[model samples]
Target: MNMMVPPPSHSSLYYCFQILLALVLFSLQMLTHQLEASSSKVEVLPGFEGPLPFQLETGYVGLGETDDDMQVFYYFIKSENDPKKDPLMLWLTGGPGCSSFSGLVFQIGPVEFEIKEYNGSVPSLVLRPQSWTKLCSIIFVDLPLGTGFSYAKNLTAHRSDWKLVHHTHQFLRKWLIDHPEFLSNEFYFGADSYSGIPVPAIVQEISNGNEEGLQPSINLQGYLLGNPITTRREKNDQIPYAHGMGLISDELYKSLQKNCKEEYIDVDSRNELCLRDLEYFDECLSGINHFYILDSYCESDSPLWRRSLTHELKKSSSSHLTDTVPELSCRIYSSYLGRKWINNERVRKALHIREGTIGKWVRCYKTDFEYEISDSVEFHANLSKKGYRSLIYSGDHDILVPFMSTQAWIRALNYSIVDDWRLWFANGQVGGYTRTYSNRMTFATVKGSGHMAPEYTPEQCFSMFTKWISNLPL
Candidate 1:
């Protein structure tokens, strides 16, 4: 996401974003803010072919306060464009526990894990040309602890969406204090997927602190989100999204719309028509990937037995390699490469991950975090009134948090349409459709993309991002 001082009342879905919840616990005085963060300059990575062309720093920032024993890890990449002038971004990945490293490599970072079958060595890396770092400095973070190399004294105790926002705000302020050189830079809060649950809340916290005249104030321009989950409507919109995409029949859709009132999830037990239609809907999407409907359904598991099967096949090195790993063609297999890479001791040492702090590093920590805030639309509504710019984009193919849900929330704000729905282009072809609102909020779609649209359509997203952030027409 970029911030190029967008035209007044125009927020084309390329510039910036944010999300939100309720409680604001910004007691800066209670926070024992420290300037000394344990960070390392990483010029070389184990799997990369040579020295990194861009600057990379890995470090730990105290979340709530110093001595809190909950360290949040972050990967800071200075903008390849111009750190002195480019906007700075605080990126949060979804899954609630998915490491922001996934955002760094799999989504918008300069480097990505080279996908290949395991040979017991380091998974190689390659550069991504469409990295968002090309536009601005990005701090990809592992929030709420227990993710990536971050550790917490009591992970079980910290299980709320509000806590993530609380700590994330602290993290941003503390990180800025440590690197005061970028204090004047335009800052944005950006995230995707489930993070849409907390990002707006964090943005609110920051806004609250800034208005209270907190020290080292953030220039806080705007925020951006991709395929964001704004409210519980995400569950209610899937059936319609499926129907619109031809994944379900018209008859089934009519039955659902009439009997369920378009609410497939949480249906009344006595509603037999709704129940019957839902079963058919489920059957229709049986093998479809909820994250991306077009892709073959693949379990995102790289279990020990699967690896053992790979090793057993290594005995011949020419066992056709077919069916050995059903996930080979799946995009998640690249995540498997990342899991192995981050867990390697040498890679850990190189990245300066504190030893003994965490167990095997996971791409996403599937924690049953307490869902304290079910609806964050209020946060967006609140931010919209504050006149902070925001860009909300969705991958048209994502059923998990359908674009329809995003549109519903945006409409809920009741802002006048400044720019009507129209297709935005990239490379002279349709990139996606966009609409701007009177509240400085813009919405857009990434054609044929799934969740985390940037991961699947980097160039188009970058094109969309650069244009909106630069205040250029999209």
Candidate 2:
């Protein structure tokens, strides 16, 4: 692993980024007063990585402070052919502590897991081809430090939402400057889960920059989200919809009713029955050990567990791994073990889980949930006002940040339509579909999928993105 260290804390990337955001926020204030500034996207030379023939570069981006020299890891991947033919896609993984690089290893990249060995020992997911890399050159990053190979000096230095957005801006800005040839390429912001929150923030911040005529303008094409946690206020709000929509079974409904009045739900809301069911679902997933309960149907043995995701995972028995292992299962199970599981030579030598993983993961979740509900609203509205593409997608079976939560959040956006909303097949499958509202916002769903939409249904996930960016029907 390449280690990039910053100087002792006199002047740091973190401080500089904050200064930049303060300046941008102040500029927005002036824009409210009708003040004018100049904005344009930067141009950069296309990157290349020799023998492979595609433009690719792996390096550290300077951030935080000039004197202290804080930095983040990012890989720029692009097509070798005409830049205009493919759009620039930024991919981020959740865990706020997790590295964008992990996405490269697990999902949308040239490599994917082959799963050569699967004994009782935890299966080490390996490298295989991700269908998305075939459509677009994807960039993966490690933000807020301690994720994958990303390094940070201390815990306190890595936990701020404001800091995350600031560093992200500088990271992209530097990327554009370093590779000026792809100036005309369209840029799309995207991520999954907790990142669902940060993606909007970064996109909105960029759009805000455009409105104020400050900084360079990015094409800011649109956004692509997979089973994202888009709304906090709507957290428990989706239960009724979940029940009414038949997402949960009648048996599960009764279980919820009996338990909530006695064991789980708060029941103060309007949809008491629905909320009860949703609370049962939440209680069913409160701990990592109970994770298998969420998708027990993926296996081929446990009858009760097998019934949970019956509609989603079509296996008749339990004990069999789901068609595709969930990234959530992989993460939570690993996180539960902490450094104890990292002692293996392959793991220790391959990545730095023992050193920075814990801090990054812990801080990532802390900052995301620590804010007021209104903060999310401001972030979403600001994103739409700036012409940035904002997307909230859900997997029907994803209990973590369920589709119900996303639906409520979309209703909250209320972005005025530039074009009438359109609905159509997303992957040519009856179960998958897309709906575009106001020409700038999109809400879509992947059928029979859980938290990691792409892992469960790569073809559908790829189809959704290709159509979204190219403005074509699947």
Candidate 3:
């Protein structure tokens, strides 16, 4: 038997090499076909600012169902001031249904439009230049099969989380496949609420490369979560923490604090006072609206048009007709049209939420949303482990997905710190605080803002992104 084994060595090696070559050739054939179907051109233009040149172009992906493949409408805006100097940002909006284009126009786009007073109707809102687009090329994406102008070929394949992830994966994969050029750009993915899942999941998927040993790949630089809700278990545990932090109300806070203390049978921990203060702060948040947390609009002699239009902006009696939620208000004012301007059908179909339901309606067409807070925490952990950059910025007054939730999430990371945490002060206001964990995950808060932090404080958001893109070490 020993003599036989020695005799087979050279022949076995040659046979193995033949098999490997065949597998490699097969993979190359498959990838070449996929690449051929996906290739497209991206348009680049000189940026108004002297930054890198700017590029904007749209791309679509076919979901592959005989009946209906998902279609993604996406645009990549990149800065080209210096070929070696610009970064790429991928921006998605929450609602699992909201349009990223809406965010671009109303919140962080290159323009802002103000609603006119006196129901003037014609040219109701005037356009104002925004400051964020000056720094980075923003890629606005409409996803999940049914969001905005993006659509699926049929109804049967719609509204699945697995599909959501898969379709997005296919779309983005093809996008890069088409461009192939921007794959090396420093890229970050960010969105609010449910996008918390897709954004991180996609990143992890790309990193896995392929369990099937496929060759198509994505190179992601880092991740940024604006208001991510990843785990239900951790979310429930943190509810009290969220309440303690002023994201909810005192009554809700008191109930949870008492319940947790008794149930856990220990209240003397060093975190007790911090928990108590957090509870107290959160109690006040319940009263805050889903929109318009800014008190400036209510102050008399306020420079905002809302004040000028109201007989008593201070009197909570703002007109219901003209004063719908700020999001809708922006739409009406900008389009110079009535409810007709709102994308009602798309919103209803995409989010799985019925038309015209008030309150924070971010229902995903995926899972029942048992809480993926753990996944979010895990995402931050992995980023820190790989020595990559990440930023978690929250709106101080967002009644929906309160800033308190974000604070609790970070505290739970238990990361070791290089720099003792300190509040980041700006213009006499605590813009936010910076904490460097031994691993490099930095968490910050946007002072005096709501869920739409960038929309409210574009300059600060831009500054944060700019600094992050520089890849500066903590």
| lDDT values, one for every candidate | 0.80, 0.54, 0.52
Candidate 3 total steric clashes: 27
Q: What lDDT score goes with residue 165 in model 3?
A: 57
Query: Could you give candidate 2's per-residue lDDT for residues 363-470 as a string of tens digits?
Result: 122223222222355677766665566556677666545676676667677755444434445445554555667737777777776666776666677667666667
* Per-residue lDDT of model 3, residues 1-474, tens digit only: 456445667889999999999999999877545422332333321112232233445544555643124556665555535433456567877655555765665566653444544243222223334434555556677766556546555534565444555566666666666656666666566676556656667666655554444445555677787755554232333445445555567665666556454232233457565456444544454344443355333222122211111112112222222434344333223432322223334423322322332232221222221222235567666666666667777766654455665667677878777767677754456666666666666777777766667777765666665666676532
On lDDT, the candidate that comes out on top is 1
Top-down lDDT ranking:
1, 2, 3
**Candidate 2 vs. true structure, TM-score:** 0.65
Considering summed lDDT, which 10 consecutive residues are worst modelled in model 2? 35-44
- The CA lDDT at 462 in model 1 is 91
The residue ranges of model 3 lying beyond 4 angstroms of the native Cα positions read: 1-55, 65-68, 83-85, 117-132, 210-216, 233-256, 259-287, 295-375, 425-430
lDDT for model 3, please.
0.52
